[model samples]
Target: MTLRTKYLEPWIQARENLERRDWLSKDKEKEETQTLIDKVYNALGSISWSANIRGFSNTERTVTLATYCTDEWLSDIQENQMLDLLQRRLQHEPGGQQIKVESVYFYILLKRGYDARHFTCIWETRHALSSGLGPSCIGFLVNVNRNHWVAVIVNFNSRSILYGDSLNQEPPNDMLAILHWWMHHHTGHRFTTRSLEITYQKDAFSCGLLSFNALAHHFLPMEYPLIAVSNVRNGRLKILLDIIDQHLDQAGVRHLQGRTLLTSLFDRASSPSVKNISSPSLNPKPLLTLCDQKVLYLPKARLG
Candidate 1:
């Protein structure tokens, strides 16, 4: 049987069945929902039997799933942080309800008798009947032995509801591309690239999509050429190095020439003594001293 047929279809049908039943109270409904979620996870665990068969155990694995509910669903609650903002929306405003669920599954897959933990996020698509626009969710698959994780964010909203095929447009920013390029350039491990779906509403930003990677996560700044690239991209190469210099100075990574130049420039700009030595002849001694110290010097005269 196909993976989806074996795994997802049954789980989805079970969830649908649970949702169709009328519960006495909201608490009971919530409990039923939780039970359905548990059942789905358990079914998923069974379907992913290879994960356990390969010396991988549930003791070292954990999955976290965060579900974002629609405004209408949220309004049913007595008090919520997002309630006030939802109430003030104009009537014409798209009242479509969307639930985005992001799940990060961490697995400890053994390699050569050594245990390794990997993290992955997965995406799932679900639609609410009240809101015509379908919702997208995230899912993850982690392989600890491979030191890799895969994350997928599915976008289920109709093209008209979103950006009318703008969702399929090429990326405007080069950040992820540059990051991927630099990663492969240095590590020699061909990093697979995928685009994540991100959504913005007014001032709020949400990660509606994600790209999956099959390599261990590395600290971005620690990678050399990439760090340089990022610094240049942020227009902070000079400033960052300067700050690093200051830090290094505090850490005793002192360069005497740099320190001297900096201090001399600062003193020349701020010192009161420079004001007193302004006159060419009256304070010739101080002027000469300044010249001797190389604090003040004239440029070479150009011949016409």
Candidate 2:
């Protein structure tokens, strides 16, 4: 099947970007990228041709991911959906780091009501507290007036909440109030809150991508630092490829062999996008680092 025109351009642009960046120096690296692109192309073709795919299964989710990979912005809810997938992967990590990824809806619900009973129930019902104790840390994204996105990570280990905005703006007061109440309810005391040092977005429409990067920056033990703002386009492409790679793996089609999406990503050792930052380090042993859609550490303990 012919790759759709919409998808064709993105893949072509991705190939061009890879070559222009000189990331594919070796023949093996070039071949690997081509194979990965072919798989993404095939996946895009499959979903475009499939019938009656109404639900947001792995296959259906590909549509949203494909759009994102092509440098389009996604809704707050869509960002949460992608985060949910990453949350699942994080759970399977080998370490004892217990992390909770809250949905944008979770924040929405907080806005509607601050009932302690209601939230406590919701937390328990959703298994937010795995061992009858809450998770080590809770991370979530906030949609600022439905216009821009920001990432907030509450690290119980450090007893601090890091608010990350690519625009370097202060967090909304109401949102901070909700967080203050929520944390007190969970821990019997207020935790400190501060702004996380984040890469500024050079362009609009990349906050969602940067939000993902922020989460990875504070939690995942990535070999490199946070992705630079200028490289967010490439970041989106890598994210889309990671989503496609996982979808193919889940659907039992992992034959195409070479460097994994992240492996290939790190191949660009000289790319300025992999700039370092001074932030709290996570357990350097996460079985899976956030491939694109991106941890926290705390001891197991009962909530107060």
Best by the lDDT measure: 2
Compared with the true structure, what per-residue lDDT tens digits does model 2 show for residues 1-304? 3323332333333333443434433564555445555444444433322122232232342324535544457676457655765576677775424787777766777655574436643556235533446677778888888889899888777778899999988888888888787777666677898887678887878888788678766666562268876566556656665565555555665443333332332233412221221123521112123222111111112000
Candidate 1 minimal-lDDT segment of 10 residues: 210-219
Model 1's C-alpha root-mean-square deviation from the true structure amounts to: 29.2
Q: Model 1 reaches what TM-score against the true structure?
A: 0.17
TM-scores, all candidates, are 0.17, 0.63
What C-alpha lDDT does candidate 1 achieve relative to the native structure?
0.25
**What are the lDDT scores of the predictions, listed in order?**
0.25, 0.57
- Model 2 alpha-carbon drift over 4 Å, by segment: 1-61, 92-97, 115-121, 125-132, 254-304
lDDT of 2 at 54: 32
Query: What residue runs in model 1 are displaced by over 4 Å at the alpha carbon?
Result: 1-99, 106-146, 158-194, 197-304
Model 2 residue 55 lDDT score: 27
Worst 10 residues of 2 by lDDT: 295-304
